[model samples]
Target: MIIGIVKEIKSSEYRVAATPGAVTELVRNGHEVIVEHDAGTGSGFTDEMYEAAGAIVADEAERVWTSVDMIYKVKEIFPEEFKYLREGLIIFTYIHSNAHLDQTKALMESKCISIAYEDISDDKGQWPLLSPMSELAGKGGFLAALHFSQTINGGTGKLLANVCGVETPVITIIGCGNAGLGACELAAAFGNRVNVLDINHDAMMDAKKRLPQNVTFMFSNRENLVECMKTSDVIINCVLWPKTRKDHLIYREDLKLMKKGAMIIDVACDEGGAIETCRSTTHTDPIYFVDGVMHYCVDNIPSAFAQTASATLSNATLPFALAIANKGVKQALKDDKHLRRGLTTFDGKLTLLETAKKLNLPYTSADEIVSTF
Candidate 1:
């Protein structure tokens, strides 16, 4: 099987889907790896490195896309890439079908096998492919707050860290998942008072054991949320909002409850999902003001740390990619039930229930499609 690696073309997206080490692994397995020229440049891997790993270096993305059996990527397929979609082509990537209706349509119309990394579940019910990037996004979200909080960056000029002879800053984190824990770890390490709120008692208790004494765990109720808004210097939201839910956790009017100059860092930048005011932003123009409250909702926060993000993401996704390559998409989906959960589209049918319900499209179960194979 031939695996293609293409450079990410999304705005401010520097992370590559595969590193030379990952290519080496594919080559070692007797699979032909085709890497587009400069595909890994943003992640600090040169073309020579890919060549050293026994991958064919194509001068153009078209060559890699056309020649490979499967296209391994980091971001969703853009409109420009939509023309490349064809029957039986396998796209293994972070295909957020529920968010991008047009891309989902293209995938279905093209009859391609599209697997979403974000939807893939492990035996523990955790998103293994999405976890690495989520952790990085959480840590990077806090760093963004630290940078934007400075007066020079047009922020409130309030320092996010604790200072001598001054009151300590408060950082409020919503949810106790991987992203929230990552943000809490950084916030508490800076000696700032950190409050982690979640409805899950088990999750909160687990977070409490790992976090510092300065960190407080609270129930995620309306009262606690309002209180956090009024007191916290920074609020980091890590909840993954459902695509079908129309209501928001933080409404547009709720921004008024926050302190003046306070900022919100939404690690899960689901537009109109969790936060009513959140619209996806790019790193080039990451922040905006809504009712005088600053919002930092860059959709791809991990892209800011391309090298680390690429390495970690590649490590998590390589095994699954290898499985599909070696066993073929049908056999692999049939064998691994967890991997089948990621199947968004197969043979021109929408196989993901969430995406079908969100987009009002026809639904086909992955199990049903795999059984037919």
Candidate 2:
């Protein structure tokens, strides 16, 4: 099979779909890897690196897009690249279809086999492709919030960590998942008064036992959340429900309840922001004010540290790419149920129930889709 590694064109997207080492692995396994020129530059990788790894560098995206049976990418195809889609050309990437109606419509209309990385679940019920980036975003979210918490940045001027005579800022987290856990880790590391709230009793219990005494764990509810928000210097929003629009837990009026000049980090911006005031921002201009509260919601936080993010993301996805390349999607998915869950769309039909319901499209049962394979 011929694989195409296309350059990512999303705004501020810096990670590449495949690194040179990844290309070498595919080449050694009797697969032909065609990478677009300068595809890996954002990750500090060059064309020479790919050439040395036995990959053919194509000057044109058209050449890469049309010639390959499947096109692998870091981010989903942006509007500029949408014209390259052809029927049966498989797209494997982080397609946050629930949030972007236009992209979802394009994928469905194109009749391509669209495999979303976020929908693919492991036996432990975790997202494989989306995890690395989420970890990066979670850590970045804290820094973004910290920036906004400074007086010059329109914040209340409360330091996350206290001095000898000063009080520490309170960091309130709304979820206990990967992003939430990451925020908690950073906030606690910075010596802030951290409060992690989650609806999952098990997660909250685990957090209570694992974290330091300064890090508080609480059950998530309207009363608790409202009180926490009222006093919080920084609030990190990580709540998410995969394959559906995010529930805006913080309403427009909720920002008023928060302390003036408080900062918010909505890590779920790509899914949908957790805060009503949260709108997607870029690294170049990443903060805004709403009702005296500062919001930092950059959808692609990993882009800020491309080199580290690229390697980590590529390493996590390499095994799955190899599996599908060597065994083909049908056989590989049949053998591994985790890979099977990755199939968002196949054979001109939407196969994921949540995605179909969110998109208002007809649903194809997972069992039925797997049976076809």
Q: Which has the greatest TM-score?
A: 1
Worst 10 residues of 2 by lDDT: 269-278
- Report, for all candidates in order, the number of backbone clashes: 0, 0
lDDT of 2 by residue, 1-373 (tens): 8999988887778889888888899999999999999899988999999999999999999999989988988887788878887787788888877667677778777888888887788878888788888878888898888777788877667777856788778999989887888778888988999999899999888777777788888888999999999999888988874545556678888888988677788887743445767788887788877777778888889888898888888888888888888988777777887777877667667777776787788877656877866
Residues 64-166 of candidate 1 have per-residue lDDT tens digits of: 9999999999999999999999999999999999989999999999999999999999999899999899999999999999999999999878888889999
TM-score of each: 0.99, 0.93
Model 2 regions more than 4 Å off: 242-247, 270-273
After superposition on all C-alphas, the RMSD of every candidate to the true structure, in Å, is: 0.7, 2.0
lDDT of 1 at 264: 93
Candidate 1 ranges beyond 4 A from true positions: none
